[model samples]
Target chain A: MQIRDILSFSMHAATANRGRTLLMLLAMAIGVSSVVVLISLGDSARIYVIDQFSSLGTNLLIVLPGRSETTGGPPPLLGETPRDLTLEDAISLTRARTVRRIAPIIAGSAPVSVHNLEREMLVLGSTSEIFDIRHLDLSQGNFLPPGDPTRAEAICVIGLTGKKELFGNQPAIGRWLRIGDRRFRVIGILASPEVSLGEDLGDMVIIPVAAAQSLFNASSLFRILVEATSPEGMEQTRQSILETIRARHEGEDDITVITQDAILATFDRIFKALTLSVAGIAAISLVVAGIMIMNVMLVAISNRKTEIGLLKALGASKGQIMQLFLTESTILSSIGAAIGLVLALLGIRLAAFLFPQFPLYIAPWSPAIALAVALITGIIFGILPARRAASLEPALSLARR
Target chain B: MIHLQHIERIFLVGDEEVHALSDVSMTASDGEYIAIMGPSGSGKSSLLNIIGLLDRPDNGSYELDGIKVSELDEQQQAEIRRHKIGFVFQFFHLVPRLTAFDNIALPLMLSGIKQEERQVRVTAALAAFGLSNRAGHRPDQLSGGQRQRVAIARATIMQPSVILADEPTGNLDRSSGIEVAEILEELNRQGITLIMVTHDPDLGRRARRQILMVDGRIEHDK
Candidate 1:
């Protein structure tokens, strides 16, 4: 049969049982759309994470005080007594040839009260170089300048959340807030960083490292932030830094080196597996839809037996009869597939709007796969009915009313 | 021309072999109108089916246009049926879903005739059968005579060499049956062989040659 004839025949068949055909198409659409949305969300999450890490400067490396033996756990408390990375280690790493920038961080939790507003917040103390290494954007005044180290300078930069919590619509740049027992002037306000995959890292405060060290009166250091020249040089730079730190600490394997890309890759694998599992579950509905198509086609053949016999008697060969029925079923599935594709696209768009962090990307391969799946479903389910129609005895069928 | 030499058709029903057609032999020349008349189980329909290539005989040599058809494979037989045979049935089995025009165009389509040629021939056939006004009407929309006319139009659309009508007017009234019979005879007059199966003696006697079948055997030939 010609392509036009097949298409028209299929349309007629599908329209003949509109409700059932529509339900089958909806099932197929849900299957395809869910897969697309899940995979897209996973992809978006990875992209968000990579962008977050990249903005932190390619040269930067974070050194937490004590490494946790297990992966993915909360960091050990500062007062719980782990071997704290100190100013001596930071100074030695800074003086090393491979290290371009080194900043010692002293972090603590403190309640900041400005007028009637009070909220507990994480506070980090670091040198001016920390701003460049962490790629912090200043919304207001300047960072702490290099000056006398002995005198405690009460100057700080507040994050967007910290500023909002303390000032509440009031200007926060040049304001004063109490950190622990000491009062500090906010020299600058950090611009709110964009949330990446729903993770907001801009919820803290920064002050001069020396001033914080004296105010806390606790130690030489808490954590050290180091920045290498290039990511490619990371391995060698890490080796040199580790060797130098170990040599200073009398040969100890106490530090861990982790890259953002490796963590992102692990997340990607997990989400991809999740998406496939969800899609597999949804695929069951497609099989059910296929069975429905088969049942309907069989009924159509039975209803049209005399017509088929008439055609056969009027010179339609067995193959031609078979093609006609097969074409009918294929028409049903092709329309279903087309409808499914449109629904999937709409579903992805709706999901993307509902959850900004959840990206729903529909790859071109998805529609191609849907079409192929529909075609195969049509043929596989269509075979039994087509065969039944072809096997009808022309004489007997003609005898039927 | 058509020839059947010593044709025998047997049916196996639950370990009992019933002869649907015994040693039957007949010849039908081009442009001849013939009818086979018989009661129920008399093998009249079975003989027509064999002649129409709708069934194969258990033992026989059947030839159409001097080509031995009984020995041909299923596909070969189907090819001959497609190109050489047409059938009009007792029920006027037009597809309910198709319009009268499309029903008549079906055979032309199966023969792979181009759409333009099919349209021309189908239009002519529809007009010839006085169905031009009902071309777009489905079988249910047409009367019994009109449906029979559509059936005849479909059967002859391909211009096959032989037209087989098995009780073509069985479901129609007397006047409608006469109209259908005249259409078949006109096609036969145009040099196409026409073989019909009927139990009505009046209809049987209208044929130029008549064969009477009884108990799977030809009782008389005239």
Candidate 2:
């Protein structure tokens, strides 16, 4: 029989039993759309993480004291055989040709009180270049003015949440707040509405490195953020920083230098694996759907024995009978796949709308894969029932015994 | 012309062999109207099935239009069946999901005839069977006589050389059964060989030639 004729005939048979056909379609559709939606969510998470890291700065490298070779978990605290990374160590990195700039960070918690209202918040101290390096935006006044690295300027930038808590909508730009025994003028308020890697950007305070060094009563820098002059300069810049820090520390090579691309690549691998594994789990449902098709087709064969007999009596070959049944299942699955794609798209849209930061995106190959697998599974599962139908003896079937 | 020689068909019932057809040999020329009448278990339907290539005998050589048919493979036999045979059943056996038009178009569709040609043939068949206005009606919506007419139309849709009817009017009322029998007679008069299996003596006598079966053997032939 012609392909079109077979398709139409199968399609007619499928539509004839509306409830059963709808149930099968629904099962297949759920199988496909779950794979799609789950994978899209995982992909969105990957993209979001990569975006957050890229936002930290392009061609970036972070130098932390002590070595950490592990992909995740807290950085292990080793015995103090390694020398600390100081402000001088951060400044010495500027000598490398590939190193465009550096911002040494010292992080600590400090109680800042204004008008007798005190709140303890995270405080990060860095050079003025950190504003440009970390892409910080100012809602009001300028950030810390450029000056000597050791100069103890009593000035700070509070984030939006801090501003609301410390000053309560009163202008915070020029207010003075006490930070652990010293008072500092607010230099700026951080911009509204930004999140990096699930961290709210408007919930912290920034101060000059020297002022924070004295306020926190410690000198070791938390991390040194280095920017390579260009993307190609990242490797050379990492090498230079390691060598410079090693030379200053008597060639111990005690620090860990994590390139931004390496971190992003790790996250990408992790999320890709996550997406693939979840997609695999979702594929089990497709197999279930296939089995359901096989089961339903078996029942259908028995139910349509008279029709099968009629067709056989009309000179339909066993192969033709098999083809007709196979065609029916494939059509059902293909339509189900199509419906699944539409449902997944709708689900993605709803997710994107409900949680704007979730970053749900559909992978291009998902629908193609889902449809191909659905069709293949439909046929594979279709074989047994088709064979049974084809093997039916015309006389026996017509006898209805 | 059709011919059969030394046909043998056996059934296994609880490990006992029951012969359904026993060394029966028969022949009919083109356009012959033959009636096969027998009581239940006498194998009239089995004989009809073998003649229509719907069943294969254990030991037999059958020929249709001078071609060796019993020796042909399943596919080759199917091809011949597709082009050369039609079957009508007691239940009418119309696909309940399809309308009368689609029912009649089935054989043409199976033969891979294009839609336009299939439509033309089906339309003509519908009118020829006086079912033109009932083309869109499903089997359940059709009267028994109408359903039988549609079945006859479907049986002849491929324009086969021979038509086989197994108790074609068994489920119909007397008036509708007579109507159906008359349609079969009209098709036979148009030069297609008709072989019908029935237990109704009155209907059996209407055919030009008749055979009576008992205990898997022909007891009388005329």
Separate DockQ for every predicted complex = 0.55, 0.68
Q: Give per-residue lDDT, candidate 1, residue A283.
A: 67
Error of 1 at B194 (Å): 0.9
Candidate 1 local lDDT, residue B60: 84
Clashing pairs in 2: none
Candidate 2 Cα deviation (angstroms), residue A185: 2.1
TM-score (C-alpha, index-matched) for candidate 2:
0.94
Number of the top TM-score candidate: 2
Put down candidate 1 lDDT per residue, A1-401, tens digits, no spaces: 56666566556655666676676566555555554555455555555555665776666666665555545556546544445566667777767666788777888877877866778887788888787887778887888776543345888888888787778788877778988778899898777655634434466778888778877786657777788877776677778777777776655546665554455567667766765676666667678878887887787788788878777777677887788888888877777778777777787788778977644467646677778878898899989999999989887787778
Q: Estimate each model's TM-score.
A: 0.87, 0.94
> How far in Å is the alpha carbon of A42 misplaced in model 1?
4.9
Tens digit per residue, CA lDDT, model 2, A121-203: 88888988888888888889998888787888989898898889889968888889988889999988889748776556676
The deviation in Å at residue A104 for candidate 2 is 0.8
DockQ of 2: 0.68
Q: Per-residue lDDT of B6-97 in model 1, one digit per residue for the tens?
A: 99999999999999999999889888899989899999999999998888888989999999999898768777887888888887777777
True contacts kept of each: 0.49, 0.69
